[model samples]
Target: MADAPLNGIRIVELAGIGPGPFAGMMLADHGAEVIRIDRPGRGGITIDAKDPLLRSRRSVALDLKKPEAIAAVRRIVGQADGLIEGFRPGVTERLGLGPDVLLADNPRLVYGRMTGWGQTGPMAHEPGHDINYLAISGALHAFGRAGEKPTPPINMVADFGGGGMMLAFGMLAALLHVQRTGEGQVVDAAMTDGSALLMSMIWGFRGMGRWSDRRGENLLDTGAHFYDTFECRDGKWISLGAIEPQFYAEFRAVMGLDAPEWDRQMDPRSWGPLKAELERRFREKTRDEWVAAFAGHEVCFAPVLGFDDALADPHNRARGTFVEAGGVTQPAPAPRYSASATVAPTMAGERDDAGVLRDLGFAPQEIAALGH
Candidate 1:
């Protein structure tokens, strides 16, 4: 096993849905000793035996409604550096595992709370999903074609980005605070808040009058001809991200686009015609041919690859970006560190109660009692 960056950090994840497991996986990926507490009988939606994101972490199935489960969690929390939970507001408080109770026992434990809405809004208690959260966060509005109903970005916006990524970031930030002041704090990571934060760049663009709420009309939102995907000859697609003036010029030059007419780069009126012309040119070649042509160029071109294709790509294979573990091949750890690298383990299974408790400083007898 490689030396993990967060080997000394311990986290307890009270499992729910979506982002909770993802955030737990992120912490576990970086060498944090993350324990996922499942409420016995909670079946996961998808199970890939070799997926790397599921690596690391021990699981402990407990019924939080029971006194025994509550006590067990308290003991675990007492020794943990962080605790993450994704339940509707008040669920943890009702279980007696709330921030107030846990922080009282471990002043240095960062309590990370993940929710769709915020912690203190009128809609906090309302049932919602990724789509609902993104809708309210202004993310959905910035997606899809102009003057058309907004399309969902496959729940990636709220579930992973706003929910999981934000929770991880907030937990890390809180960990820094605990290290400084020895006082643990509650991290309210709401999907709505996170989604809005993800749009900070767009917000800045809007402030500078370079963006509009209408979708398919901005440089980054597929509104520009140079920053969108086009169909190729084989029915596959290729993405082009020649956003800057120099890159666009290089891209046009590579494709042999003529001057004067092609020089009208940022004109809104010329956008539709330019896109049509570019589409025609893109259709002349297969995705593979285009990839071969732009093998080493500043055109910022790539195939719109699916997951299976992504794993098989030459660049991905060369970099070992994906690994086979637990009979599955999934993405490897990211953001490599020079000194402390992440280790990729096989897919995790059900939580190992006795084994995990022993590692967390329980006596043999105590482990046996917990099993009972």
Candidate 2:
């Protein structure tokens, strides 16, 4: 951990849910000393100590409604490099820990704000979750079948991808700015904006007249026969992405798709029929059988693994893609570094409140006054 890129950085996290905790986890995984300020009592979507998102951070339970707690947060942030919060707009300002106050206390503090609608839009103060955010971002419209209602990708796109990950990136960018200029700024990371930004390539495709507004009618949205999932004989699934001509030819050659109609690889009218043929062909073999068939081929094939299968997958195991911590199996820290390797995750555990406060140079009397 000494060589970790964020080893010397400290972050104060005003814990809420979802993206805020995820950002803190990303920072903590990279060796930032992320101290999370949790509510004194559990409420909506509480993250238990063993939750992977809470890993590698020390939690301090403080009632932000209390004046002493607010002061304690200020004391902590005054010496920290960054702070993350996911409250609705104006909530932190009401609690007296807004960016203005914290940045005044520490001029180089990168204040990261996570929200679904951003800090200034008309819907900034509205209450919404991942689905609602994707709905507004136009990402949801591109997620379903050709004639089906758009399916949510189970919060992965907006919550973790756009919201939390983008906040982490913004925090690091702002932190870099702070290092260079001895100044800080607010990072308004809105899920809506981030999700829309994620669609840049698709927007470009649309602008180039290669994409349509219709759902699942584009090349990558499962509209093409070569780019969709298929059910196997055993009821398990497999996916294909044989978009390139060579790969598609390999797919057809391997699957015995020698009919004349199968040559129309890019014809929209032939996709539905080709997909039907693929469905029938795939159901002729079990998922494992198909996996074995495509093992050394370049058909862009993979089995759609479930959690247990994913954990036990040979490729995943070889790459150490998942690790066990605190008796729970979860994904490992990603984007591995050659020089600044990230720290292995540890479970969130009980902390000595007074010890933590003392490390922060808080006197015993002051700690007691804060009811720590």
Off by over 4 Å in 2: 42-47
Q: Give the Cα-based TM-score of candidate 1 against the true structure.
A: 0.94
Write down the RMSD of all candidates, one decimal each.
2.4, 1.9
Model 1 whole-model lDDT (C-alpha atoms): 0.84
Candidate 2 global Cα RMSD: 1.9
Cα lDDT tens digits for candidate 1, 5-48: 78889999886667987888888888898887765653632233
Judged by TM-score, which candidate is best? 2
The best candidate in terms of lDDT: 2
Model 2 quality (TM-score): 0.97
Worst 10 residues of 1 by lDDT: 42-51
Could you tell me every candidate's TM-score relative to the true structure? 0.94, 0.97
